[model samples]
Structures are given as structure tokens and as C-alpha cells.
Target: MAYQTFRQEYLQVPPVTRAYTTACVLTTAAVQLELITPFQLYFNPELIFKHFQIWRLITNYLFFGPVGFNFLFNMIFLYRYCRMLEEGSFRGRTADFVFMFLFGGLLMTLFGLFVNLVFLGQAFTIMLVYVWSRRNPYVRMNFFGLLIFQAPFLPWVLMGFSLLLGNSIIVDLLGIAVGHIYFFLEDVFPNQPGGGRLLRTPSVLKAIFDTPEDDPNYNPLPEERPGGFAWGEGQRLGG
Candidate 1:
């Protein structure tokens, strides 16, 4: 019964978030068990090009350092925010969500070439947090019971916390940067006087991931709820 209950709860997580968090956990477990070396998963242009090791591009974002506090911290944020976004704004829009992932990943990869950073999972988490916060700006937030603020400040608060932890803020900044670009293009710019949608999901991707209207499981909600409150329910400790 206990196993079944656990399984049920696990199955409740959104599909993309579930798959992503599972990959991160399993990747870390593989490294911790000595089944794989960390060197193999890091981003390397030479390995990707000369050696044709394309897996590194994707794997780099799957493994955060070996199972430790930082790993746990990042995983929590990644899973929480990613799931919230998936079930919230991006709900019923699987293809759009996937497009966001592709868009962010592609931008991050391009920027990674100029920066010395590898393993972009942290940055990716920030991007998720950024999008969630922006879409739910009126939602109140409390950080570690010490500070209170609105949703949009979440990313900067996280960057500050990262600075305090002595971890580089560059990754967090990068996530925020890319996230803003996506948000502006997708959400902001499109609403301008003459602006039009810049991020249209490909028809093939939509057909593959989106549910048909006739499907019983298909349900759609307004982009923003009528009330000032956001439908998401979760607690954020810090960052």
C-alpha cells in the first residue's frame, strides 16, 4: 500500500518536470555510484564538434555536482518551479512549454560558448523560476521567513542568496537574462502597439505534444485567472 501511494504521488507530477527531475537525480546517482565520471557530462565544444559527442550538450544540463547540498538545493528549485510552470501557465500547452525549453536551451548553449561555465542545470532552473514569477507577479512570496516580496523578485533574491553561498552568480544571472529575453519576446513585445507574436510553436511540435480538442483529457484555462491570485500552490524557502 505504501509503495502504491508513493507511486501515485510521483505519478501526479507533470510529465516534463517528472522526466527532468528524474534525469537529474539518476545522473547524480550514476556519478555517486561511480558508474560514470563527471568529466563525461560537462559541456565541451571540442568534444561536441571534433569528437561528435553531442550527448554532452544535453547531459551537461542533467547532472548538477554529485549528490550534495548544492545538488539538493538546485533539484528542489528545478522540480518545484518547473512543475509549477508546467501545471500552471503552460498547462494544456505542452508544445509551447517544450518550445520554451528548446528556446532557452539553445540560447544558453550559444552563450555557454563565450562563458567558462559548464553544466547549465542551475541556469535552467533560474529560467523556470523567472517565467513563473513574471506570469504570477501579484502572488505574494516569503523567503526563509526573513524577507517578504512579490513574485518577480524571486530570481534576484536567489542570485543574492547564491552570492552569499559563495557560489558564482553568473549562472543565475545567465538564466535570468535568457528568461527575460524569452518573456519579453513571448509576453511583452507581442503586446506592443505594432508587435506581433515572435515565438510561435511549430505545427509539427504542436501536433505531436498537444492534445486534440476532442480528447477527453483536453482542458484549457484562461491565461490568467480572474482573481489576483495565481492557482499555483507551493512554498519557496530561499532563492
Candidate 2:
């Protein structure tokens, strides 16, 4: 019964979020078990270009190191915000959401080339949180009941928390920059006078990822449901 319940909940997560979180967990587990090493997963431009270790480009974003406080903290935020974005503003828009992921990821990769940063999973999570917060600006949020503010401040609050932990703020800042660029181009500028929709969902992508409406019984799930408000003060660290 417990396994079945867990299966049900797992199936409820949207496809992209489900795949991403699964990959993260599996990658971390592999590292923890000594099956893989961080040296293999970090972003190395020379290795990628010269040695053809191209997998580093994607693997760098999948690892958060062995299980610990940072790993658990990042995973929670990633799962929560990524799921929320998939189920909220991006609802019924799978192709566009996936495009956003690709876009943000490409930008991050470009920026990372110049920075001495590895393991972009934390920054990726921050980007997701930033985009979600921007879209839902009015949503009231609190961090561990100690800090309460609007949704958009969540990313900055997280940056401050990272600072407190003796971690560098560059990753968090990189994420915020990418997220704001996305928001400005896709959401903000497109609505301004003389502005147009520059980020049209490609026809091929729509054809591949979007659901067809011609089918009368193409239910994708137990029915479309909203994500839970799992954020706020009561939630414990590493939860």
C-alpha cells in the first residue's frame, strides 16, 4: 500500500519536473555510492572541447554532490518551484515550458564558460524559483517563519541564506540574472507598446510536446491539478 501510494504521487508530477528530479536524485546517489566522481560531472570547457567529454555540459547541472544539508536544501527548492511552474502558469503549455528550460539552460551554459563555477543545479533551482515568483508576484511567502515577503523576493532571500552558509553568491546571482532576462524578454517586454512576441513556440516543438485537442478522450492524468503550497516558515531544513 505504501509503495502504491508513493507511485501514485510520483505519477502525479508533471513529465519534465518528474524527469529532472529523478535525474538529480539518481546522479547524487551515484556520486554518494562512489560509482561516479564530482570531477567527472563538473563543467570543464577544455575537457569538453578537447577530450570530447561533452556529457559534462549536462551532468554539471545534474549533481549537487553527496547527500548533506546543501543537497537536501537544493532538492527541496528545485522540486517545489519546478513543480509549481509546470502546474501553474505553464499549465497546458508543455512545449513553451520546455523551451523556457532550454533557453535558460543555454544562457547559463554560456555565462558559466567565463566563471569558475561547477555544479549548476543550485543556480538552475534559483532560476526556477525566480521565474515562478515573478509570474506570481502577489503570492505571499515566508521563509522559515522568520522572513515574510512577496513572491519575487524569494530568490534574493535564498541568496542571502546561501551567504550565511559560507557559500558563494555567484551561482544564485547567475540564476537571478538569467531568470530576469527571461522574464523581461518573454513576459515583460512582449506586453509593452511596440513590442511583439519574439519568443514564439516553434511549430516543431508544439507538434512534438503539446497535446492534441482532436482526441476526445486524451486525458493526460487523473485530471489537471494544482501544486500544493509547500513553502513557508513551518517547513524544516532538509525537508
- Give the alpha-carbon lDDT of every model: 0.83, 0.82
lDDT of 1 at 72: 79
TM-score of each: 0.89, 0.89
Q: What digit string (tens of lDDT, one per residue) describes model 2 on residues 16-118? A: 9899999999998998889999999999989999999999989999998779888988888888778878877777788998999889899999999988898
Q: Which pairs in model 1 have colliding backbones?
A: none
lDDT of 1 by residue, 151-199 (tens): 7888999899999999999999999999999999999998999999989
RMSD of each: 4.7, 4.7
